[model samples]
Target: MTEAAFSIADIPIYGRILLAPMDGISDAPFRCITRRLGSAYTVSEFINTHDFSKLRHYQIARLAFQETERPFGFQLLDNDAGRMAEVGARLYELFKPDFFDINMGCCAPRVTSRGAGACMMRNLDLIRDSFRRLGQAVPVPLTGKMRLGWDETDLNYRAVAEAVVAEGARLVALHGRTNKMKYGGKARWEPIRELKQALPVPVIGNGDVNNLADARRLFEETGCDGIMIGRAAMANPWIFAGLDRDEVPIAEVFALARYQVRAMHAFYPGEKGLVAFRKFIKAYLAPCGLPYEKIVQLMKVTELEGLLEMLADIEAELGGQGQSRFGWEGLANPFEKEQKA
Candidate 1:
């Protein structure tokens, strides 16, 4: 393994590229896959305290992780400072994660409408209070993931970041866009540069990084201590291994896909696992040029054994082990720069 890129609190992060903590998507099975492929560490999906306080089984299950996923974290999302601290402390005793991350970046209406996610940025006092309380409540290091702010007029990420760190946040991951931007428009990298210069903790730059090339640009342009990949990682997990989607061989893709489905089945069990696996089928087969009909056929399968068999058939039909039947032109490669003649 390479030397640590940077440390959060006292924990050393072995790699600079980390899989972003995405709700519904960054589960234990997926985190383990990415971690094995070279992602530095794992962070559980957002554990909404509102749901957790109610003893929601799904919310509690999100915290499940293996020992291999060390330097792991539980990302807590809620508007209540005391509730967040209370849950953070309780969770530490139950799960013993290496750290706890406060979610201040999610812009989903369901999240912000309650003044939780990005809306939390509108209140600096809450940010300070929440972190201060969490610092006191949880024994592990506290961290934060936030946006530029509520919107263009409210770009106060600097103040929000400082407020959290003042209390005890050891690391700050900044997604360059504001809540208003949601996911539209280009993610502003300048603010990430600004935060890197201003913040005392390790700054992980996120947003608009879709591949290894974008990852390189983020590190070069911002001089950030780390990079976080989100949406792009869904289709091309090999990005964690420093390989682009097109660069991955068909055999390797099929093998990983099989592994992921089996793991998901074990994690979720029965048809529940098969249903969850459908979300990823499209992305894993994106490079194959598999017809819409064939893709739909595979997704509609209701059993794990049946689905595995179908995947094997598709892999063989598309060019088994040593060859690829898909067109390279069909796959998007943002890293391929225009040449100047």
Candidate 2:
């Protein structure tokens, strides 16, 4: 493929860094911060096809993103071939993502047991038929994200990958773990390489890309077209900006915490906002090297002013350490003789 031609499965993905659709984490507000941070493209959390057709208000809200988050779209999960296409076509017209992604990868107990998500891999006919319908129904390109298989006992990604493309999908992303593995074992990059070798369409690699080095390594090893990041972005939104990886400043951490609280309030309002943002605090403080529990406690506090106060207190505490904590020498004399002139 030409370097200039960057679209994946018809989705104009220029940067090659895709944000994985994480449940409860890849919401619009979080995505906005991440998009500003590193990834070239972003996607919404996996909304069930059944829920989309039903017009679940919360699910609809999840898809609500600003123009700045463009080249972004929603991921849907379903097994019903007829229903999938019908819903896929409607989504093409109504929401208009860069492309529509089908989730054949999620192994959530509820999703899998019901013959959806990762379970689709076990049934070749359904997988083929769904892609066939989806390709025909949606004017947009059809792409799919899938696991290695349902579990260790049934490693069938090769077949599933071929079937999806035959049914009309132009691109495929492999997550490298079976449904049974969940988040357990290491995500096998070898399988991804094999899939890339097998498929004509570009393959995007997901899983275990927790840092720039990991992203680099995956590209080097798999020769996949791109990398998809998830938990890493949740921890440090500045990761993509190339700032934190070089040198993290105390001010940036404090500002991010405050921004998150304000953004949460704007979206969720009141007590829930306060409760919800607590999930993100510890990652922000990883560089500070504080105890995770202490960070979580600090985050759980509801008062926004109280949270800022704690951050200030922590900074003072850090300063008191006299470079011992951060391993950086303090500026002994601010401007000293140089600025005296």
Candidate 3:
């Protein structure tokens, strides 16, 4: 295989894999634990800057990263360049992250219909201005995350990447599908490859990078400088560290589920924490291969104690899947070991 065009991302990635910004799921503790597990960087969960600025008590607790997760960044999505710039300037001053990214690739209907995310790509002039304004307003290197385009017919990845560079964007990350495709079809790596070839600034690849093999191939196949993982972190944050088959038992799925429940309680507080935690448990338990009867019972669980009781009981009945002989260097040595397999 050929060498990666850009081995490390903006400034210096420190590590290889990065955690994607998932709105609710990628909370502070989630990012913390996952970063401890493995990841070069963790982009705070994407939120509309307008919504964030308007929050009366906007803590953005997740943005509080320790010195360890060196090179942190926050991703914000907004249609108005002025708003994006205004917010970018504030975050650049307060957080001083390695970079500030504008989300131009979100596929959510509400986000796109309003002419944001991939939908924003339809207007090249606006897209360019968004970058230009942000680049000028923000202190840190300006960055953007975008999709291929509106759809296959309007595959303008090359033009957009070039324009972002022209607008003074230091780097651009491209999700291979159009807004219309959402997370459906296979990610079009060709666009990433094309963008890599078309732009001087580093091009990062996204979409479907649930595992290390996929990540390795993303850089190799597309010539992207880096890979950003979103849904993959939800199912298994360890993917950034090792393959499911190569790493320790996938049985840790249960443990991760339990941890998330406690984290939600700590992060959210009150009865609402338990409620939101339940929604996240669905993905962790998917590998347990639970029967409908058992799943219904587990799903019905509302409180932390109740959920743990059921999972612990299920653990014994399911042959204790988490027990494994595998070892992680970090877990072993703690200091010398860096992130990756």
Candidate 4:
């Protein structure tokens, strides 16, 4: 498939580069920052369909978005078609998101234990029924994010995509690996190319796109309508903006990290907000290659004022250095720890 072979549906996917919905990471603050930095589209962290019904505070926080985050979808995960449809209608009335996405690629044990996420691919009947129910319940465009299948032997990417499209899905994002791969090994792009050829709807390819060259390769090779980025975006928030780490100054890194902290504080407030922001510290400072001990020190400073003080102290400590210390290569992805294992 050539770049010319790729085409988008009538739906408003402003740009081809999209921010993938990630649990615990794609919060209101991060989405808003990424949108401003240049991510064409952003998805709310996947919301459990049942939880959407109650509109809990944390769920509400997840759904909250700035006006700048236009042309984004709210991803939903569920096993029961009837309940998904009911909640879809309720969410439409309350949030009115540009689109609603069924999550079929999440590999988390808790989610799969509920027979949702990537587990949905194992049941063709459920995939078809879900699209049907969601289409009937919500008037907005429908989309889905899915892995190739549950495992190597049951590679049902095409079958599941066909079922959803036939049932009324406007778009499909295919993460090249199967559920068994989790975050391990390389993502095969050939399946994505084949899925693009097979489906009438636009197909977005995901997995392992860590830089601009990677984004171009995904498009040039698979001819996917767009590319969705996950973990890589965490390390470099300006990734979609075409900004490389070499171009970013140490001061700007601190500024961006501080801005994210401010947004988290504004949205959540008090101790809860500060604690939630802790997860981002490493990713924001990834380019600087902060030492593990320094990172641990920074992570332990939970309070906003204390965190700022720590950041200043670290900057002063590295003031005369010509280049940053190196060790990021060995850092564990705190976000994907459970899935990677």
Q: lDDT tens string, model 3, 1-341?
A: 54333422346554556777777777666776678777667677775877767876555454555455656777878888888888888877877877777788888898888888778788898888888888788767777788888887998877877887787777788888888898898888888888878788777789898677788889899877777888877777767566562363545665665666665665664565567766666666676678878877877776779878987888778665644322321132221222111
21-46, model 1: which lDDT tens digit per residue?
98878888788878878899888899
The full ranking of all candidates by lDDT, starting with the best, is 1, 4, 2, 3
Q: Give the TM-score ranking, best first.
A: 1, 4, 2, 3
Identify the runs in model 3 with alpha carbons over 4 angstroms from their true place: 1-10, 59-67, 245-247, 321-341
Per-residue C-alpha lDDT of model 4 across residues 89-200, encoded as one tens digit per residue = 8778887887889999999998898889999998889989998988899878899999989999999999899999999898899999999999999999999999989988
Alpha-carbon runs more than 4 Å astray in model 2? 1-5, 55-58, 243-246, 291-297, 312-341
**Deviation from native of the Cα of residue 259 in model 4, angstroms:** 0.8
For candidate 4, the 10 contiguous residues with the lowest summed lDDT are 332-341
Candidate 4 lDDT at 60 equals 56
Any residue pairs clashing in model 2, and if so which? 38-240
Return the clash pairs for model 3, or none.
Answer: none
Which digits, one per residue and each the tens of the lDDT, describe model 2 over residues 1-70?
A: 5353357655566577767888988776677766766577777788788776776454444666656677
Decoy 1 TM-score against native: 0.92
Worst 10 residues of 2 by lDDT: 332-341
Per-candidate TM-score against the hidden true structure? 0.92, 0.85, 0.84, 0.87
Who wins the lDDT comparison? 1
**lDDT of model 1, residue 232:** 94
lDDT over C-alpha atoms for residue 109 of model 4: 92
Task: For each candidate in the order shown, give its overall lDDT on alpha carbons.
Answer: 0.85, 0.74, 0.72, 0.79
